[model samples]
Target: MYELRDKDFIFIFTGPNGAGRKTVAQMSGETLGMKQVISYTTRAPRSAEFNGQDYHFVSRDVFTEAERNNEFIEVIEIDGNRYGVKERDVAQMIEKHGAIYLVLNRFGAEALKKLYGNKAVRIFIYADLKTIVKREEDRGDTPELIQRYTSHYDEEMAYKDQCEHIFENLDLAHTVFDLTKTLDDNYLHRNLVDKD
Candidate 1:
């Protein structure tokens, strides 16, 4: 197991579907020089998503086998597809980068927070239902998928208060700017405290 320092932050970004959580997390991580933690998923890749970059796409059998082996730190099933982060992968990233960000669902975020305590910073990025629907449609999501995601909007929203930060992602550029600024400030503060 990799030792965790107080200064090592695990940023967990989560929100309802089509809320732009992934994009915001990726952009903010890039700007802040934090490593992005790619999760393993049994779901098929989206049109623009790649096997390695976006997610380690795998078959259900493979995912089940990994789960049986206790390879995952946290796992959740959404829309009948399983997604999880490997424990070894997270330890490697933290060993290399000190800080890392992950785009996860509410369950996964909660699990990480429980494991890491305050070192886990949860950020909930969300938009209005109309905006979410529009974004999903623009992304060419099927009607069934769109409906399934939107139906869980309220449930996901209920988890917002459990997060450390909540942001309305109406504009991509502004959201990224705000997210990165907050992260940078926190990182600097943690380092300063560590030095003292």
Candidate 2:
């Protein structure tokens, strides 16, 4: 088996709503001093979202232009909006260290895995349905949006099936602890060691 190292390894975290992959990405980004490749999208900005930080809001025309220029590492249209990670953002981080990660939905990650082969680690994040409702509520999602997200939970859970490793996210510290433990083991699966 290929050894997983803190550096020179990319981790892909996938899971259903409230599964906390985004939370891991944010935490890992801070831990590694890595800049997130905030995606560009055609959707209207949410009340809490800002330009060039959470996401790079762009007109559909501009997004299309950028994609045509081959500026994106990966791009996809979802829910009638175009979203993508630019190639330059990914390249800069990777050029410095091989430890870079992309938090993607099912489609993007699947395609990337196919193209890149075994270079990336797939970490699936998941939680029970009750956890999902609370997590979404904690984010201040409205009753209606929460209900909609809840309804789609099945689709999200399906994403976990594709991952090689699975994590049940309970909180920020809990998830980080798991990741750090993985680091301690030199990134090998813990079955190689005895745990009481």
Candidate 3:
């Protein structure tokens, strides 16, 4: 029903805590000419996140004002913390470049699909739970990682099943190749074949 082409893609990524979604996102950012729009969050920065690099850390007041102005494409409160992705953020790219990319959670993914109508594309990056657990070990994930990942386990797998496309990334090289192949002209048929 959607008549748009591949260039109109907007990525919506979801996962349990340590599924390496960030790594895949960064790869897409670099190779796909897609900018990773920094999220606005009230949560404090973790060791891996540098100020302005991972997110635009803001006080509640700044976020509230922005929300009042109708700035966000999607906004949600999770675990008592607010997070938002500005609508202007995606519109700016689409207005000038004819396409835009958004990396977001499952909830935001569904929301964007609804808002954008035919303009959005969903790509779910997934890994085996055992592989994800090993990835966490390599990244030095603590008990916190285990807890958070466990919490979203069902939702994470569900996103993959429900999304327009899904990629399994247990092997880094294979994942890279798959993602690269994904951007090719032939990729659409591959997705169809996968469904069959």
Clashes per candidate, residues 3 or more apart or on different chains? 0, 0, 2
What order do you get sorting by TM-score, best first? 1, 3, 2
Which digits, one per residue and each the tens of the lDDT, describe model 2 over residues 1-196? 2333345556666677567777787785565444555678898886667898767899999999999998876788766888887767655766675566777777667765765567666777788999889878888999887886577578777877678777888877878667645643554333333243
lDDT of each: 0.88, 0.70, 0.69
Clashing pairs for predicted structure model 1, backbone only: none
Task: Score candidate 1 by TM-score against the native.
Answer: 0.92
Model 1 Cα lDDT, one tens digit per residue, 1-196 = 5679866889999989889998998887877778988999999998889988999999999999999999999888887889999989888998888999898889999999988888889999999999999999998989987998798899899999999999999999989877777777766353222221
- lDDT (Cα, 0-100) at 68 in candidate 1: 98
Q: Which window of 10 residues has the lowest lDDT sum in candidate 2?
A: 187-196
Task: Flag the better candidate by lDDT, 1 or 3.
Answer: 1
Pairs that clash in candidate 2: none
TM-score of each: 0.92, 0.79, 0.82
Residue 100 miss distance in model 1 (angstroms): 0.3
The digit string of per-residue lDDT tens for model 3 on 1-196 reads 2244545655666665566667777775565556666678887877578766677899999999999998887788876788888876676655555444556778788888898765676778777777777777776868676666567767768777767767777766567557646754433332322321
- Residue 84: error of model 1 in Å? 1.2
- The most accurate candidate by TM-score is 1
